[model samples]
Target: MKVAVMGAGAVGCYFAGMLARVGHQVALVGRPQHVEAFNTRGLRLETKAFDETIAVKASTDAAIAADAELVLFCVKSPDTETAGAQLAPHLAPDTLVLSLQNGTDNAERLRTVMAQPVAAAVVYVATEMAGPGHVKHHGRGELVIEPAAGSRDAADALVAAGVPTEISDNVRGELWLKLILNCAYNALSAIAQLPYGKLVEGPGIPEVIAQLVTECKAVAAAEGVTLADDVDSAVRKIVQTMPGQFSSTAQDLARGKPSEIDHLNGFIVARAQAHGLSAPANLTVHALVKLIESKAQ
Candidate 1:
């Protein structure tokens, strides 16, 4: 498969390298420096199992995706439309656009901007850009994608590349569940710049998490998202599963980069307004992150 990673960040480089490793032709479309680095020395893949360099095509221009059969759209939420629009004119009409981004609405937003079919996927991974053209995987890598017209074929190809995927109709529910967890922990983690384990151990942290989860559940229900009954269990599991983890948003903030805070908790707040419901907890988290975001810049 000829694959193009639309945003050559951590997730993009990691997945592109993986596909290239498995003998798929993958091109990473991103920043100029990253492209130069990859073209010079190949993408560095550092994982718990092994570390190696995998050579792949890298480009900054969106037109690099002109020949791609599969487009891995991995930009952050706020840039979804801009990124999609950049590639819109170049994307093939039959390209299977898999949104490997955070937040729930990226696929829909991409569909609107690109005028192409886009599929949503719940990304379950912890990856980071260690250096130019280098991707380091710290943890899980699986996907729960929604049932789109071409999703089965996309999943099969990803699975062939050793990427686990489950195609389902309840992907939105799953995305909301993840969003609930993010609203609860991501801001606090970013603000304190602490790992999940340490953050959860602080006094009143558990209470605040519970409150945030409750607020999210209320907001989701009002928005007609049918979440699983085990929301708290999922929330608690993130700490134990990724105790040493500083969330992506936390890492972004620490790196003085922009976060998708507006798309995560802020999205919840927007949905709350649409439903005529209040989401004080989510709104508070969004506002706090916004304040810190200003300082970060």
Candidate 2:
């Protein structure tokens, strides 16, 4: 299959590289630096398994998606509308677009902007741009995508390309589950410039994390999304498992790039307000990120 990845950041490059490794034609649309490196040599993928450079198509132009049968919408939440619009005028009639992103509303937001079927996919992976045209995978590469009209076929294709994917009926709930994890740690860790291990080792850290989890569960329940099993356990486990990890938001702030706080905690806070509920924890995190954003300016 011919695939086009809309945002060639860590997530986009990782999956696109996987597909290209399997002999599929994949093009990555991303920053000029990455694209130029890819065009000159090849896309470098560093993983726990091995480090290899895979040859693939790379472009800085979004219109390169015009002929693609599958388009992985991997841009950050803040760039969703603009990226969606850039691809909207050019996508093929039967193109399958999947929003492989962090926030919950990316798929719906894309649908409003594009006439094609956009599926929401929950991604569980830790990856980063180790260098120009280089994507490094830390762990966990699995996908739970919304049950869209073309989702089953898309999932099959993804699985064949070595990406574990499932077409799920409850992708929205899964998104919320991931959001809770972010709400509990992303801001706190970012502000402290600490990883999960050190973040949870501080005085009163457990109590603070507990409060955030409780507030997130309440907001999710109010919005009719089934809260994850043992929210506390999930949030706690991420620290034990990926103690050295910095959230994409944290990385963004550190690099002076724009963070996606407004879509993560801010989205939860907005939904809570809509349902006559207050999400103090989420609101607090959102405000802190905004403050950091101001300081970065």
The number of the candidate with the highest lDDT is: 1
RMSD (Cα, Å) of candidate 2?
1.5
Clashes of each: 0, 0
CA lDDT of every candidate: 0.86, 0.85
Which pairs, if any, clash in model 1? none
Per-residue accuracy of model 1 over 22-112 as CA lDDT, tens digit each: 8889888988888999999999999988899998888899887887888899988888999999998987787889898878788888888
> Which 10-residue window in model 2 sums to the lowest lDDT?
227-236
> How much is the lDDT of residue 176 in candidate 2?
89
Model 1 TM-score relative to the real fold: 0.95
What TM-score, over all chains together, does every model reach?
Answer: 0.95, 0.95
